[model samples]
Target: MGEKQPNEQLATWFVRSGWSKGELARQVNRRARQIGASHISTDTSRVRRWLDGESPREPIPKILSDLFSERFGSLVTIEDLGLKAVPNLAPGSGVDLPWNGSQTVQLISDYSRSDLMLNRRGFLGTSLALTAGSALIEPMQRWLAPAPASGGLPTGALATARGGRPPTGRISPPELALLESTVRMFRQWDAQNGGGLRRKAVVGQLHEVCDLLQETYPADVTRRLFQTTAQLAHLAGWMSYDIGMHPSAQKYYVLALHAAKEAGDRPFGALILSDMCRQMIHLNRSSDALELVHLAQYGSRDTATARTSALMHALEARAYANLGEVNKCYRAARLAEDSFTDISVPLEQEPDWITFFSEAELNAENAHSYRDLSYHAGRSEVYALQAQPVMERAVELFAQDPDHQRSYALNLIGMSSVHLLQKQPEEAAASAQQALEIAIRIRSERVNTRVRKTTAAATDEFRGVAEVIELRDRVKQELPEYTRNQAV
Candidate 1:
């Protein structure tokens, strides 16, 4: 109906495939017949139209995805090809369901399949929209629904939901152990390097895990498998978020939550919700983030450890801070510190996934809270002064761990923000320079964004100072498009 613009993404894939337009049309028509779309017909003109920005009906996109995947010897998605599916073929359209159902597999499988092409789709100049905070709340509600009067949801529940597969050929213990170790390995890599490096590997393993879920296993093995799957999905989601692929990250987090539910791991599900809340806050949906953090705390009330509780409380503080509620934020921050001090269990006995929430991590969250409050709470110097000591402590702790280069860099930016508000131009520029160096090394858009944002703040605070000018020049060289004119 509108002016026809070229679909360069599809054109690029077509050119890479090295096939004539006629060759593609013939393959589509042939694949259509093979798939029983006998009434369908495609000619070279149809292919040309698609390249000219016309979306073909169903079956064509699927066929092309399959064909290109084969030709490329890797997974290719409809999104990677830049083709919109007909309404009936849309992903997850009718499959949203309760956590402990066959639909879990479908949801994970569909999402992972699409995510395999996530890195490739960037060139398409489009992306899936982020799921709203309210949409994520519904899944949390389902997760928090009361468990059966029995100790837990019955093992038969999983079996029945899985459509009663035969019990033989259960997954071996060694394979399950390997899967778990792989998850831990991936988690560490994500914490060290940014998500951009190994996100695809995580997504690829997740796809295979979904296939394994299709087979019946011993009840204990089933739960373990689901736990492993959930952990992998969560790591994949976090990685995606680290690299700024928000929609994909949200999808992976939701899948992780459902898988955690199936595994009956309430504490882990709450963690996923909190992470989702963190993402929402980063996207400027702090109001929604507040709701999500509340849901997380309530849902995990009985199951969460002291450290996990502290983590949730810190996130609550972050939400309140972003909302400019200084009193509430400070109160929540104290609660976090108190919760940390009250840890009854030994650090080594806590869940491996959450053990990373050490004193340093808490300080990092607290510093961000204070930094945000400095701006929004209308007492810039006062709150920034409050942030300075904690921010410095976080940077010092993170500096001892070279693996957490990204976190180290980001905290430096936060420190720089504090200094800028305190009218310390030299200190702000120094911290900004340190963070920029790290941002240039790490494969994280988040860090780059932090660098740009800090540079923007320095630009506003110091104006034309030679030191600020030099920082601007370096930032412009590294991020050419984000000059002084851009507000970041």
Candidate 2:
């Protein structure tokens, strides 16, 4: 065999991380454990081999990329690490490319079609690497520019025999309204039920809408059609995320952002970016999430209504709380509350999408932010104590709506975490049991994920307790294998 070439790129990132070889091995193993890959144990010698130019297997390159991305608060792909020969462990789904409005439609059609195919094939995990939120900053900046006027469309439904090919069919206002109504129905279902039951349905609907976009319409109708398309794409993205198809979710979100821009709905675009920020936070990239939210807030400052502003601030609080910034978290939470109180628009006047950010939703965001704060505050139980009343109020409000089971279930998990932070094992277990009961009824993988995380915490805290043991057993039986593996 010839002499081996050193992996300079890997060596550079390793030096930048300032972690010893052994520490790198430990972190790799820990990350593997989080993903239920219990078999991935490496020692310092393995790390040395990697640095000495031996290409690691399928997951190590991906895992190292993720680790370095989180460490550097930016994207670090496999190619950046000089491990391009290893099969890419993550999926992108073409979200990183720059595309025009027509290209955006194609992207949506391609992504949703593949999503349906994967679902039909009984695929559980998506073969996608999530695009980092930080990587979206420049694209969002471009989206902030003024949208071009929707001119040059046919004035009436009749297709003019110009030099170009005519549209497939004419889209009327009634058709646009029907599509809008369908989006509303899908939104309500997603809110009440998790994304699993109807995700495929949403994707199918999105495909239909994309096809409709090819039809002829007046400028006003065309704008509304794109608006409806944006809404459908955003819902599809959220459902994808809810079902744990995270890479697909990221792609759909990028598509939604593009559609929203084409529709000239700056506020809605900001909302989509905020939702993307929440996903980043879930992926343990709070710094990137914080930056993304700031971009959203800044970009929509003029166009965002009071309700949208409140929701954005609440999400900002969530990112801050996850980052352990106590003061910033509370400050953003207070801003959210204040924004809600200052709403000048009537409930009926606000957009259909922002209408859901009512007082109950704000309270839920605050409750979650406070619960996260409790964990980050170290030994202090003050934040934990503060979380209870907010959580109680949220639970009370959410309980009033029986259809809002997923929200209710999530708050229960939050409440349980607060109880755990306060050293109330019995209360924590009780709340967790309640959450699990609700979670099993819901079809949301996100709820199942919460159950897994909470159960893992309960197990760690009350290792020998009968109730916690039973909770773990129930989770194993109810949740999927991936979730069950992570719960341990």
- In model 1, the runs with Cα more than 4 Å from the true position are 1-97, 123-126, 147-151, 154-157, 160-165, 479-488
Tens-place lDDT digits, model 2, residues 394-456: 888888878678888988888888888888877888888898888877778778878888888
Top candidate when judged by lDDT against the true structure? 1
Off by over 4 Å in 2: 1-93, 122-125, 148-168, 482-488
Model 1 per-residue lDDT tens digits across residues 207-245: 998888777676677778788888988988888777655
Worst 10 residues of 1 by lDDT: 479-488
True-structure lDDT of candidate 1: 0.78
Provide the clashing-pair count of each candidate structure. Answer: 0, 4
